[model samples]
Target: MTPPLAVDIDGTLTRQDKSIDPRVFDVLRAWADEAPVIIATGKAFPYPVGLCEFLGIPLRAIAENGGVVYVEEAGEVVYNGDPDAAWAVAEAFEQEGYDLGWGPADMVNRWRETEVAVSLDRPGDRLRELAAREGQEVVDTGYAYHVKSPSVNKGTGLVSAADGLGLDPEEFVAVGDSENDAEVFTVAGESFAVANADEHARAAADHVLDASFADGFLAVAESFGIATQ
Candidate 1:
C-alpha cells in the first residue's frame, strides 16, 4: 500500500520568504503521483489549494492547526475542534490590555522583545515585542497578533486530516521547523527537521537537514525512497 505523507510548508519545503526551490516541485509532484500526499500546515487560507493543484492530488488538508480540515473530494471544510473559547479568551485579553494583533488565519503572534503581560490596552507594537520576547507564544500567521484556539494546533490537525482520508496517522512522515510542528513530528512515522528549524523542532525530529528548505526537502524525499535526489 502507498504510504501517506504529511508535509509542512514554512521553513521545511519553502524558504523564510516562502520561496520554493525548483527541485521541490519535481520531487513533490513525483511523490504525489506515487502516493497520497497531504498538506498539514498552519495556513488556513486557500494557499494549500495551490499546493494540491501543484501536486495533482485530491486528498485533504489540515489548516490553521486542526481548526479547519479541507477535503478535496467533498469540496468542503470541517472544524475538527471548537476554538471559540480560545478565540474568546484571546479577544478578552486583547480587550483587557493586550497589544495582540490577529493573524491572517486567526493565529496569535508576539514579538521577541516585549513583556509577557496580557493586557487589553497594550499597544499593538508593544504586543509584538512581547511576542518576540516570549518567542514561542502563539503568534499570528503573518505579521498579525491573532491567537488561535488553545487546543487548535498542527499536530491535532494532522491527526484529523489523516483520519478524514481514512489513513492511519502513524503511517505519515512529516517535516517541519517551528514550535507548531513539534507535535506533528512526534506523531509521524518519520520526521525531519530542517537546518534552520528552532530548538524544539530539531529535538522532536528523527533527522536534521544539513540544508535549509528546498535542499532539505529534496534530501528528505531522497531519504524516503522518493524519486528526487
Candidate 2:
C-alpha cells in the first residue's frame, strides 16, 4: 500500500502567517503523483479543500483536525466525517468553564458569519484571560468566536477523518506544532514536531524536527524518504 503522508498546514508546511511558498506547492504537486499526500489541519471545510486545489494536488485531506475528511475522486471533495466525539470532549471543557472553541467544520458555509466562533485551548494563560474578558463566550479558534461551539477541537477531528478514510492510524504520519495537533500524533504511525513547536505539542510528538516551517519542511519530508520535486 502507498503510505499516507499527513502534513499540518498553519505552522508546519506553511509559515506562521500561513503563506505557502510556490515551490512548496510545486513540491506537493510532484509528491501527489507518487503517493497519497494529504493535508491534515485544524482548519475547516472550504479553506483546507481550497488549499489542496491551489497546490494542484488532489490527495485526501483531514481537515478541522479530523472533523471533516475529504478525498478527491474526480475534481472536488468527495468524502466527509463529523466530529461527534469532539463535540462531547469540547462540551466537557465548556462545562469546566475552560472556554472551548469549535473548528472550521462547525461553520462550513458561514465562515464569515459573526455568530460562529473558533476557540484556542492553548497558551493556557492567554486562553484564560480571553475567556474572562470575552465572557468565556468570545475567543478566536483561529477562525472566529462563539460560546456554544466550544466542544470542537482538532485531535478528535483527525480521528474522525482517519476513520472515514478507511486508513489505519498506523499507516498515517502527522506533523504539527501546537496543542490542537495532539491527537494526530497519537493516531499516526509516526509524528513530528517542528523546532518551534509549543512545549505541549513538542512533548507529544514522536520526533522533533531540526527546522521550522518552510525552513525544515523539505528535510523532514525527506526524512520520511518522500520524493520531493
**Residue-level error in angstroms, candidate 2, position 207:** 0.5
Give TM per candidate. Answer: 0.74, 0.66
lDDT of 1 by residue, 1-229 (tens): 4467788776777866777666687777777876777777666546676777866777567666656777665566777543444344445556666534343542323221111213333354544443334332454333223345455567777777777667767888888777667888888888888888888888989988898876787787887688775
lDDT of each: 0.64, 0.58
* Deviating ranges (above 4 Å) for candidate 1: 73-76, 81-83, 86-146
Residues 1-229 of candidate 2 have per-residue lDDT tens digits of 3456677777777776778755567666665676667787656566777888777777567655444566654233433332333244345445666544444454442432112233444334543444444333233334333232233345554555556566666677677776666657777788888887777678889998888875656666676565556
Q: Kindly report which residue stretches of model 2 are placed more than 4 angstroms away from their true locations once superposed.
A: 73-109, 112-153, 227-229
Please count the clashing residue pairs in each candidate, in the order shown: 29, 13
Please report, as a residue range, the 10-residue window in candidate 2 with the lowest summed lDDT. Answer: 109-118
RMSD of each: 6.6, 6.9
Q: What is the overall TM-score of model 2 with all chains considered together?
A: 0.66
